[model samples]
Target chain A: MARLSYLKALQRALIDEMSRDESVFVLGEDIRVGVNNVTTGLLAKFGPQRVLDTPLSEQGFTSFATGAALAGMRPVIEFQIPSLLFLVFEQIANQAHKFSLMTGGQARVPVTYFVPGSGSKTGWAGQHSDHPYGLFAHVGVKTVVPATPADAYGLFVSAIREDDPVVIFAPAGSLGVRDDVDLETLSAVPLGVGTIHRPGSDVTVVAVGHHVQTALAVADQLEGEISVEVWDPRSLYPFDWSGLAESVNRTGRLVVIDDSNRHCGIAGEILATAAEQMRLTAPPRRVTRPSGAVLPFALALDLACQPDAEQLVTAVREVAKD
Target chain B: MEASLYRMVRLIRRFEERCVELVRSGDIIGGIHPYIGQEAIAAGVCAALRFDDIITSTHRGHGHVLAKGADPIRMLAELCGKVTGLNRGRGGSMHAADFSKGIFGANGIVGAGGAIATGAAWAFLRQGGGDKVAVSFFGDGAVSQGVLLEAMNLAALWKVPVLFVCENNGYATTLTVSESVAGTICGRASAFGIPSSTVDGMDAAVVFEAASAAVESARRGEGPAFLECLTYRFDAHHTWEHKARVRYRPAEEEVSGRLRDPVEIAGGRLDPAERESIDEAIEALLDEAVAFATTSPAPDPSTALDYLYGSAVLP
Candidate 1:
């Protein structure tokens, strides 16, 4: 067993995949020197051919990845910041994502978009601090946000292997997370499966990305009074709706803590799905950043905009009231 | 070579005209972006490419797709939105692709295919996939696009074998080159240190000669080359413009612009009897294509999202 940090797990996954398949390569800005650390040592191990250092051209490289995928290569693109996704949104969402269906299956864009420090950092300001996984989910692109180190490795593996475009967001908050993992036993986690981390029967707390840790902590704090079941939906687009239904049915209540904006977010969709389909004793609630949230540069202001433990505790408590 | 280029230009001309007719008759639902005057560019460029050479096209793409060796019957069926079409009717006019023939796709977004072609060229090189090069067919409007310029930079930097074909049909939708582009089109390639040239797009022989040199140089690993084919649009930008009456070109200008027709220019080189036979054969082939397209069934609505994933499962 070894202690693996989330960042380390990402690096290991890239190393393993590149070693396993000659078709697998990584491209990003300053990836050779590992500016984000996820691609650290990749240049030395895989050489410059496989570990390409692209210019600061998100649109160019994103679409470039798509093209390489079309030519039968598995390309993983590492974005240093989250908001850079917005710059390449058209390339990813429109061109790469649509190629399969648009070309009637003649093309398979097996490109993985890995955003290392997604969501708000301490004081990265507005441009660098946006978490837009919800946008990709809304557009039907396979979206995953792994909360733990093991999941980071497994999901990154699956994302690279997946024969479609997948955007995996490793939240800034989760970057520091370390987990005890048996290296030999670490394996791929299939997309669209949810795990109940700390199961209970009173209220089900659905958490996304880094918020899964927050939900687990909140569940622990509310353990004596409320039986809080924490469910981590690692993959957001092919959401494990059946698992969510089963949990909601068992607990009779639902609360979601998502890092996205409140309006039109994945949390809203989860709540609506539970209300429409699942058996719920009380109306569900969600904790999320405000609609159109732009994380300000100030330390406190940025923290204020992020979904936190206190908010999760309140949301879980509110859903448990009925 | 001359005869084949003439045949290709003629085929694209008639195929597009037939598509416009189908649109009028409601056989083809969405109107197509007619590649009427720009046929020689596709014919010339595609002729220069080998069977394995890849190409990524633009919205005005029927000519490119046809020139790249897609079955006209299947292409027509695609345009008609039939299950038997090239993309099983999912892609229609703007997104048709045949990977077997190395046609990457006909993209709906302008200037999007440049980077894609460059990347494909880079991968092909990495895979030791021989001297196969990639061609990206875009318009005068795409010259100003940052992505295309960035692609040129990457292609030049890595020495990726890519032929950047810019079909300068004078206008981008309703906006002319004077209104839409700044500086020069070939200057964009020159800025990236890519060798470039401007050629007459209406003459297939001229375009073929220029494209041959670029494709050959690229295949030799001499890096990328750019060709700016200056042509005119004889028909409406899109068939929708026919009804919208969005007139930007004057009557006199339109008359003069259509005079240097690619079909006529290519046909002038062919023996009169031989050209007549080729035209007759094309007419018969197109007749069969139209019949097959209209008769083929539309895709089942239940399978509307089929092939959305590589697994062929609707997620």
Candidate 2:
């Protein structure tokens, strides 16, 4: 057993996958020097052929990865800032994501778009702070957000092995998390599967990415008074609907804590699905950032724009009441 | 060599004309951007390439798809949206692909395939693909797109074996190249230190000569090269323009542009009897293609979302 940080778990996954598959390679800006520390030793370990330092052309490299994938290479692109995803949105969502269906299954792009420190990092401000996994999920690109160190390792492995284009967001809020785990136990965690962090009988809280930590905290605080169940949906797109239904059925109430802004966000989908398919005692509720939220520079303002434990607590209480 | 080039140009011209007819008759649902006058470019460039060499194409891609040796019957079926088509009707006109033939895809987005082709070139070499080159076919309008230019820079930087072919067909959907492009099309590659040349796009032999030199240089590990094939569009930018009557080209320019017809330019090199036989052969082949395209059954609507992911069970 060893104590591993969430960022280190991601790094370990990259090393393991690259060692396992000759086709696997990585490219990004400043990745050679490990600007984000997720690719610290990859350059020396994998060499320049596998570890490429691309110019600051997000659109170019993103589509380049697509072409390489078409030529039978598994490329993992590391985006230093989460919002750089917007610059390559067309390449990933419009181009790579559509290739499989557009080509009638003649091609499969096994590229992993790895965005470390996704979502609000205290004072990064507007351009660097946005979390857009919801956009990829809406476009039907495979999307995953692992909240634990073990899950970070497992899901990153699975994302690299996935035959389709996948966007794996490692939330900034969870980057500092560390857990004591057996190294041998870490393996590929299949996509589209959700895990129950804390089982309860009253309200099921669907927490996304790093918000799983906050939901767990909120559930602990409401322990005796309200039975709050925390469900972490590691893979967002191929969501474990049946798993969500089972939890919602047992608890009889649902509340979602999502990092995305309200309008057309995954939170709204969760609420709608629960309301439509599950037996809920009260109307399902969600705690999300305001619609069109642009995180302000000040620490307090940044904290204000993010979904917090307090909001999740309130949501769970409201949903459990009826 | 001349006869083969003439045959390609004739095939593309007739195929596109047949597609336009199908569009008018409601057999083909959406309109296609006809590759009428730009046939010499696809034919010339593809003639210089081996069957294993890869090529990425643009929205005006039928000529490239046909020149790269995709089955005309399957391609026509694809345009007609039949289950028996190249992409099984999943990709209609703009998105057809045949990986087995090294035809990566005919991208729907403008300027998108350049970077993709460059990356493929880089990987082909890295994966020990000896002397194999990739060709990216885009229009004059794509020269200004940042991604395509960025691709040129990277291709030159890494010495990736890729050929950038710019088909200068005068208009980018009603906007003239003069109105849109600020600099010479070849200058875009020159800025990236990639050797480039401008050729007559209407003369198949001239284009073939330029493309052959560039493809050979790239294959020799001299890095990437570029070719700007100056041509004209003899048909509407898209079949939709027929009804819209968006008159962007002057009547005199239109008449003058048709004078240097690629088909006639290539056919002039052939004997009268040989030209007539080639034309007859093309018409019979196209007749079979059209019959196959129109008679093939439509894909089941229930399987509309079948190939969305690599694993059919992902969703």
Best by DockQ: 2
After superposition, the stretches of candidate 2 with alpha carbons farther than 4 Å from their true spots are B312-314
Instruction: Give per-model TM-scores.
Output: 0.99, 0.99
Give me the overall lDDT of model 2: 0.93
**Model 1 chain A: worst 10 consecutive residues (lDDT sum):** A313-322
lDDT by residue (tens digit), candidate 2, A178-231: 999999899999999999999998999999999999998998899999998899
Q: How many clashes in each candidate?
A: 0, 0
Give the C-alpha miss distance for residue B178 in model 1, angstroms.
1.7
Give the backbone clash total of model 1. Answer: 0
Extract clashing residue pairs from model 1: none
DockQ, in order, for the candidates? 0.74, 0.79
